[model samples]
Target: MIRRHMFMSALAATVALSGCGGGDKSTATPTPTATPTPTPTASPTYTAFPLAAAAEFNTYSAAISYTGDPATSAVTLGAASTETLSTRVRLATDTAVATGTYVMRENTEESRFCVPTGQTCTSTLVTPSAVGNPEFVFRTNDATTAGKFSQVEYLNNVVKDTSSNVPALVLNRVSYASWWRGDSTAGQKRLAYTAWGYSTVYTDMPATGTVNYSTLTVTGRLVSTVGTTTAINKVTGTVTMATNFATGVVDMTLTLSTIPTGGGAPVAYGTFTAQGAIPVGQNQWTGSFVTGSPLSGTLAGGFFGSQAEQVGTVFSATGTFGGAQQRLIGVVVGKK
Candidate 1:
């Protein structure tokens, strides 16, 4: 009995020790859990205006009319006159203020009013629509005029002229290269083609008469820069227009002179002719041209403003150069 009691006591002690974990020399270290990586949040997308190409400024012309009162509040249909205004605005961004110049003409009068004759104006662009059009407002102040206001809606290259008392005036966006032609200052003239090159060919057709086959001269420059090298080459060409008022169709032909080499080794530039057509009432024209042997590509463009205007007429052209598929775009204004 004594032996059995001793054995039982020893077994109970061993059980207690084992249950108390007394036999282990050291506790096992716990395995560390890894921190989970967080998922990244997406950035919000913003709507922006649709621009054809990158440009520093956007320029527009507006025709305004005073309806309620020119002096007090007299409304009229025909613009007591019209105005062409330009401001610096970003192509796809909202701008708080854009300031520029305006040349205004009074109806039934030859007199003209110009801002910066000691006057100032401002404009702002609002949020763009889902379709990418932007709404804008323009205001100006002067001693002669107070509370002058204009609202505009832009769609593609066209702007709705809400400032007019009559039917909303429609304004077209002008290319920077074309708009540069109106700068008469010598400094401006020197840098006219600095931004981009242009070649313009223009001729006026009589309002009512047989079309004249005049040799419309095309003059300007082809400018390009690669790295630190800039090239400016004189562009000389001729254009002829055939208008059939009865059919309301106008046809054009373009012939370029020998393209000079500049900026680098002479590009094997080839001479090509293009034929394009436009409706009598439309200003835009488009066509394709094929170059001769050695080099081959296409040329296309559209004109701004009425062909009847002696000046302020703008043209934009885009074409490919060389067999390597280099592209070029340019704008030109009318001389005569």
Candidate 2:
């Protein structure tokens, strides 16, 4: 009944007994191994923790410009040589954010060369989480004037107020100028303008007897010099101060304006007026300008928050604009 070559010989003997019982074998594809390349690391440098001196906790200044033209060389501030300075910043941190080396110390003991007592001033700030306006570079290496070096251009607008105890008024703006290289005799080149302001903490003032007579109103920004022409005029607007504190005085005004070097619009400088006196328990004050035509200069400042609301100032003056002889300097801040 089954007889077709023995039924194909039983199907070839069941496929040779299923290939001798160990079937399923067909593998040949493997050769991929090459991934080894990674090496690059070097970027870290820090050294900025050393600053001490506390009062209202930070703010110091020195001014003595108006002596130039006898040069042995050196003395060039802004526009040509007008010199300006201003500051009233308060940044505090022990550990929340504020990494090393950003200091501005001043203790001229009486030698005063713009920080020179064994020399060591530092500034390398740009990391409070960095966002906007955070520039600093206040260097000093004039161990006593040899090649004579001193630099400062610190600008600040920092505002990190994580629920305050009051220490975030940061409005710093400085650009320094100093000179006295041993001979220029306007009394040896007296252009000594020094400044210092920094803090870690220590603020509490406003209670000399608690006499709040009130009047206060302030505003800021001015940066001068235009008419004896070296052209360095920033003078935008707003000075409008008016502190009375019950006749301790302080009366300021300066409509102010500028902008025109070929740029169209903005011109109308000075309404100027100044007067000062406030010292008994002192919060600071000192003035002179009386009118304004470069009438001559002098103005000092003080008072900030905790019921004084805010106010900071600085000034220096000169005369004759467009007639050939002018000079100026400024700094201001305001509120209430």
Candidate 3:
């Protein structure tokens, strides 16, 4: 009887412990692992190349953004939406471009404006100094020149062949849009002009041989032009050239971005690629964007510097954005 009583008491104790949650495991809502936020890559730095005497800029490609209908007097500027005009220009000045009076000459003609050095000018519709030539007025609103107007801003040691003691203008040139008035064969009309890429007068080029080349990563701004409006953002990417000069094959990959005007992190715009071939004994090459790219565009570029030490490209791209089609154009340049 005593043994039976002891067994009953032990069983009761076990039951009691179980009912009171002793040795019982409870399920918990586990904390979730947090997703980490990504950090943005910083924009690359660049140096501006000031204008020098005998410095020349041979335009490779350009885009014209203007206001109003170009055919009427109400139009302040006519847009050249489809045409790409090449202009070779130079300044005849020995002083700093920021404060120097320059005799700007384009090709064999002189398009004259009597504005002070680095100052913006707004004048009544004036006649072109040369009968058939267009006259340009420095009217850009760039703050870098202290709110003064400048035709060009060269950056990133962009001009090569400096060892020759001559600083010829070349790639990585950012030429702001300027105002112009011309008496075309049709009639008098106003216009705004902007150049994308430029190169120095090539006194020499690479020779044909078993040549080795390195990959060049170029950086610049991607400009977007929609009718009369213009928007610009920072861009950077890689451009691969042929291992040998005999092939002359070139390929490029780039990413565009949307930079916040209020100074914050830049948002990614898009990535694009292009491929082309350079002609023998020529500095320029042309190609198209790869098939199935997120954007459709055309690419053109050229070799810059005395020994082809630098390269540059000008591109035009179009894509759908914010439920509307947008066109983008830009210039990128890099060194060997």
Task: Give the lowest summed-lDDT range of ten residues in model 2.
Answer: 46-55
Best by TM-score: 3
Per-residue C-alpha lDDT of model 1 across residues 73-171, encoded as one tens digit per residue: 222222211112223211221211222232222122211112232344333333322323222322222233343333222222222222122111122
Task: Give the TM-score comparing model 3 with the true structure, all chains together.
Answer: 0.50
**Which parts of model 3 are misplaced by more than 4 Å?**
1-52, 64-85, 88-95, 101-152, 156-244
lDDT-better candidate, 2 vs 3: 3
When superposed on Cα atoms, how far off is each prediction in RMSD?
22.0, 19.5, 23.2
Top candidate (lDDT): 3
Q: Which ranges of candidate 1 are over 4 A from the true structure?
A: 1-210, 213-215, 223-232, 257-270, 280-325, 328-336
- Candidate 2 displacement at residue 187 in angstroms: 21
Q: How many residue pairs clash (N, CA or C atoms closer than 3 angstroms) in each of the candidate models, in the order given?
A: 6, 3, 0
TM-score of each: 0.30, 0.26, 0.50
For candidate 1, what is the TM-score?
0.30
